[model samples]
Target: MSTAPLLSVDWTDHVTGRRGHLVVDRLVRGVASGGLRMREGCTAEEVAGLARGMTMKEALHYDPRNRYVPLGGAKGGIDCDPRSAEAYGVLVRYLRAMRPFVERFWTTGEDLGLTQDLVDRAAAEAGLVSSIQAVYPLLDDEEEARRRLADAFAVEVDGIGLDELVGGCGVAEAALTALDRAGVPYAGTRVSVQGLGTMGGATARFLDRAGLRVVAVADVKGSIVNPDGLDVEALLAARDAHGTVDRSVLRPGDREEGPDAWLSADAEVLVPAAVSYAIDTEAQERIRARWIVEAANMPVLAEAEERLTARGVVVLPDVVVNSGTNAWWWWTLFGDVEAEADQAFAQVRGAMRALVGRILDRSEAAGVTPRAAAHALVEERLPEIAERYGWY
Candidate 1:
């Protein structure tokens, strides 16, 4: 409901010719956290939108009734291709310029075009610590498992990369929850994912493992489809470093080329996990899926959302669907990780399932779209919190 951003900054690297924006929607508990994305044609407005979504996500997750975690929403973007040779230098310069902000108020992790390794290196070069890393204990061997006990707390610390699994698992669980709310069976359900990057690939793999058929997956290069369901593991293994699935690795009959092939795939669930505004009005017309799980931020346009709602399609908002990383951060910092890494993942999944189910149920009860219900839930508390803290 708010049209203005809390904080927005644009910066450029004179030497590397890099430019970017940082937008913080709100500061909760004196801190705001989100991811730094690098992609061609990214804009400050887009970054601001993502930052706002983060605020909504955190507000809902940490609501007094839910009490999942306490965080605020923010996002940063660099308008450059990470594949370019100058990317490293650009990232370093960006980090250096934003060092003060990163340390004082905003903490960012990896997003679309950026990798966790790149973010870690950039943060190191900037002499700043990642927010998530700050909470984790320093381990010379990430693979070694160590258990520690306190007066009332015991936890196991392992080097396993739990953050890597959070987003995908969250998305998959949200989708499953939506299906259950709609009384749709997961078994034999077809899914089409509109990106094969970290979030998208992980979503596809998780859904496939959960007995949903991932019938199609798309990357920037193109799409590949098989009604019988693509080999999720094989496709993952065949993906290049850039996350593009090699067409050669697919069966000869599975390959398909079209700007909108993935969007039109015959499936029950469609996940737009690659880019923003993937399902505009025109694209929405081509959507055959009953459910649209937004794995990417703001993938559905407002008009498209309205249209989809009128058509009885359930559009899960990105804020709720992609809260896995946020939940993972909260759990790593506060929850008991004494069990295996999978236990942490299970916790996140269960949380997402409950949240999604509650939102969908509220929407149906109110005769409103799921997005409206989600926004209402967040807005109900955000204004009061903002007023109480004099943030408005």
Candidate 2:
């Protein structure tokens, strides 16, 4: 699709009795509605770009009869960290302030440091009901898999258990898809997952249950690697309230307490699920995994993605890996828990497998990286969708 202006968007900060202008860019409205993004350094241009990306992402994963369809994407930005109560409150207020606009076309979800509780708080303060609640599964349970997505415009969550479950399930499905495309057997495959928050931890558990050996997993504090595979169930059982695994409870192994330790683990598959740009130039050189799947958005920088691709490392794009959050919004909003889980797991796995296989095949044919091919595919689809809607 053409990278053209879609919708005009602007951000104004009126917290200190004076308005502070941030970003004003295009908001591309597709078939229905779009996602809302919250970030620290979000520019009007960047957020617009993300909005456009959402347009393409939704078009690629189209669902009819929903206003908050993937086809239409909306986003928001707050210059605050989602981890702090004060910052979170401020963001929620900002979101409430933006409700006039949010009510018009966008469905808000958490992204990048935003939490479900924060999203709910913001919606409540604004007297705005979550679109998730008006829909299916969440309309029934609204607690588990159909919870709020906080950061990254429907990517992060405050306390949405269902959202996390679905997101992780999507990543795992994408990983399995890439593995199948590469003719790599995932059963008994040694896997290492870095970053054990909602996305990382959930993906780790899902993959482990799928019969893959979860050899190593890490979080903010530290990393634990066992070549013989760590029992994810046991680790999850011991996880603390903050999602940190009490290292003292696990059987000791060749453990390390550094950010880079996760890269050195002996594994066939490596999933970087922690943070953005986690894999750098130096870390890329030392990576031992034959396949790398990014469960985290932009976990590998553009440069690192290039190097890994050059070395024949198959990296599945986040566009494919972490789509569960988006899918959950619809499922939770429109269906039951059992139906939502079944559809989410099936969708991510099936789509990942298909998308990876197609991208890899095209990459081989065109002598480009899988990442490049994935980008090309999305780019191709976006413009077509836009044109179909008479946007261009």
lDDT of each: 0.78, 0.63
TM-score of predicted structure 2: 0.79
What is the RMSD of candidate 2? 5.5
lDDT of 2 at 315: 81
- Candidate 2 ranges with C-alpha deviation above 4 Å: 2-52, 63-69, 131-160, 240-242, 331-340
- Candidate 2 lDDT over residue span 289-339, tens digit each: 988887776678778878887887778777656766675555444442234
The model with the greatest TM-score is 1
How high is each candidate's TM-score? 0.89, 0.79
